[model samples]
Target: MGYPGLHRILWTREQFAVFRDASGQSYVVDAYCPHLGANLSVGGRVMGSCIECPFHGWQFSGKDGKCTRIPYAEKVPEFAKIKVWPSCEVGGMILVWYHCDGVSPTWQVPEQEEVASGAWVFHGTTEHFVNAHVQEIPENAADAAHLSFLHEPWIMNGVDLRHTKSKFWRFMKHHWKAEWQPEPDMHCSCLIVKHSLTIFGKHFPLLDMMISARQIGPGLVFLIFQHDFLGCGVMIHSVTPVEPLLQHVTHRIYYQRSVPSIIPKFLLWAESIQFERDVMIWNNKQYLSKPLLVKEDAAIQRHRRWYSQFYSENSPKFPSQNTGLDW
Candidate 1:
């Protein structure tokens, strides 16, 4: 990982190097120096807030990415700066994208009030990769049968090692409500099939909320699963496709707990593993492989239909205010 704060920072794909300087600011620059094609990140020197190139000792300000002192030069040239992505902190994690196009993109980061307002319990985040389409990654959240097999829950004795009948479930053509089965501790019985029992850490007492499905744009989707528990709790997960087979799944975990540390560290560690399970199942899948989809695949069909709409030449306005009718 380029950043020092995270538990683990993986460098894969085209990423060459990552660094966080003395200012606590993080930067991910190109691996190979543009000057003479030497890797600047390798054997680079960090002084103050500048990184000196190992090959020529050309010094560049880490903040602006501009070559300030050329060891013996009067002025820094305009093209002295190497490519750098604008990065900032969110939910204890620092994110920086290597965007080449200099277009200052509108903030696509989810406008999360729960996390921003800081009225919740503990929160954390991690980066993962899914070799499948981004849309297909979170699709497992609604998959019923896979849980009994993949996530053999010791919490559910005798429920292990048995594949339950894949339930074909979704919202009514009207508004959708995704709630846990067998009711929660507050114990509400009414719940649709597209819900997992969101136990405090593992299973049970799944918080209830109104679920909305919208493909914001081509290769982009924003699904809203409002978690209204104990008072007010909601988190939005934005699943965006980077490539046809790769995705960036970011979760904004918001909760209303009595105290921050009430949830012990063991549970948080387990929680992270639970999340990694999703990434593993998704990244390893071969979506194009033809498989048997019974009537239970209805939700997948609904999602596919939603996805097809975006490809339409006359696609309707996305992110349109949900009329409280179609979800």
Candidate 2:
């Protein structure tokens, strides 16, 4: 759940249910009921602070996933418990920790004062379902060369990378310069970008921006954007893997109240169009564990190395073509 105010969400394939308690604390747990294998999220009701199973009225605590009560039975079984996941709410998002080895979270999601203090107003959000590995999505931030070739075209030309290079839109072009580096913390990285737009060789002062993006962990990113005319805002970008090859990506933008709503809405629309161009390529690309790298591609390799720390020896691997059901 990238945004706030969502009470329950079920990932059917993963069998993970994210819900909140009566006091508004969020929790993540295995969706299946421990008693008879009934899906809890399908017909589960929040009774006080516990979740009541729709199948047999079994109540489970959202805090620790323990069986709170079995209405019709004399006593609850000792083994009546669900697998609870580590979760927390921060920066207006409900974040659930996922470690392949069932390890606890080593780092916490930092609270953004602007978001928590009501200083920033949520303007809008955009979501895209992409068929790609989770690593490939964040890797794009470190790939500086792709910015010139893939995203330099005008937004009006459309999201197709092939058609975007047409000479018809040559008069209007986007320019970008970026630098990425890993932070002192092992789990974070920062990308600083300078962007400008030109129309017929004349730069538009209002379109100039300096954006600082911090990638927190493998799936969450916070992009702080500042514009000369439109003021400033923060965009929360999150990536959640639903399957081995499918990911759910979302972007929620919050702007200062002084900035007009139309400014953020327009920016979100334009950003979505540009972002979809990368989505098209990511959906069809294959991940190469070893790739031919050049001098300019050093950052990509460095990013991969940094991201490797998140995996363990027992982490799940994609099944080989020969082993149909090894997983």
Candidate 3:
């Protein structure tokens, strides 16, 4: 958690509040108070291990979400309670478990020594709000064709893929060779990518690098990058859905102490330029359940089948304009 305070979380039109007690234990509960429907996160205060409602002097236990006290009433009602969400702190994030069927978490978020220990120094972070389905963002890793068509030009040529043929980028280009595969675990996948810079068709050995990314669950990814000149580091990529079609994406980078500080700054800058190219397309594109695919686009269909495990019969679907119903 950020601190011992109340934090509001808005996920897909549902409101929730995360309370961190003085002892650093986090609890997630519905944002609206059960008594009077007052937003708990607006003016709520933590009393010992309970959260006090702002509209009424009602206290709810952080551990079980049962109404502990009501100052005006002599005895609290037996049925008075608030919904409590399962939560845990892992990999420097306070994650609240969510499932369409209200089932317990089937998998746990993995931890890394580079983040738990002080060996890897924090360098920089980049955050973006992408207008797309959460599934579409991770699918980019499996769509290898986009690398040459969208991101082949150097960062200096700007984020517009249409202008990559300009004279300014004639001599500079980026090369990428990547492979994507599903791990043994049904909930996880992996992508291995190799990148290099070429000027006048000559490769620069110093700029060559390899990245191994592990996609965990629906919204978390850990990418480890190794470069001959810049050393090794890990980037934590997180995607949280704020609405049905909007996602909050963040990337945090950490490197060994031997790496220069300036290197990460330059990497983040260049990475942002490349990432924005995909963001522009996702914001305006429509999701096609049955896409017309060619032989070269086989991986895109494989990714869809692998990702289908995240959905269930009760899962929410985007509202369809044709039928005026959720599909």
Candidate 4:
């Protein structure tokens, strides 16, 4: 929580108010005041242990969002309460647990030792509101062909089999391997992908990239990227579905404490260049379900299988209406 910090956020298509008490204990609740439907976040003031609605001075308990005091009334009605979400602070972030079935969290967000050991510090955050589904964003992590063609255009000209003109052969030419791990005990999955790019008929050792990512659920992805020359860093990619075809995606990056601040800044700058390029395609490209696959593209389906385990049985099997073969 920051100064005068009554943070208002839109998540899961609903308004929420997040604030901290005098003791620095954080709480998140529905933004609307239950009495008169006034938005609590707009003019609400935090008292010692309650949030007072500016409209009528009605105070709600910070712990449970139950109406604690009514300035005008002697008795507080039982219905004068709002939904209080389960919140916890982890890795310098306030995470609120959400379940569609009104159930408690089945699994907790894993603790990252890097954050606790003080070996890493928060660099910065980059956010993008993509006009695409939430699943598409994580799928890009395993899509290596797009990295060569879109992120690094120079590599495309060097190794593309334009003259040979075999689609399957060309797809297999990209040097990439991805593994998906579903840990039953943890109730999560980790995706490890390693790939190298060729430049001018020679592979630069520094250009090799390895990514280790753990998917906490459909909404949270924690990833660490390592390169031979650029060093290693961790990024938390949290995606929230604002609507059916829209998402609020945030990338929070942290770097080693020993490295200079400028190095992290430069790394993020270079990453943003490619991220924006991917955004352009993600916003426009159609989703395909039974997409024709080659040997190199096997990771896409493997990752999808692991992803589907997160959704409930009532949820649609395919998120997009345009999810058939492109041809």
Best by lDDT: 3
Residue 310 alpha-carbon offset, candidate 4, angstroms: 3.0
* lDDT per residue (tens digit) for residues 1-327 in model 4: 573357888876578888888678888889899778888899899887678788998888868889988998979998888889898887678888876667797778876778667787889888888887677887776676666555444322332223223433343233556676666754577778776666444676667788888877777877787876666778887888877778888777887887777877775665565566677777888878778889988778877887766666444323444343231
By TM-score rank, best first, the candidates go 3, 2, 4, 1
Local lDDT at 171 for model 2:
99
- Per-model TM values vs. the true structure: 0.54, 0.92, 0.93, 0.82
Whole-model alpha-carbon lDDT for candidate 4: 0.73
RMSD of each: 10.9, 3.1, 2.3, 5.4
For model 2, what is the alpha-carbon lDDT of residue 209? 94
Supply the global lDDT for candidate 1.
0.47
Q: Clash number for every model?
A: 4, 0, 0, 0
TM-score of 3: 0.93
Over 4 Å off in model 4, which ranges?
Answer: 1-4, 152-177, 185-187, 195-209, 227-231, 313-327
Candidate topping TM-score: 3
> Candidate 2 on 150-170: residue-level lDDT in tens?
888999999987799889989
lDDT of 1 at 229: 47
Model 3 off-target regions past 4 Å?
321-327
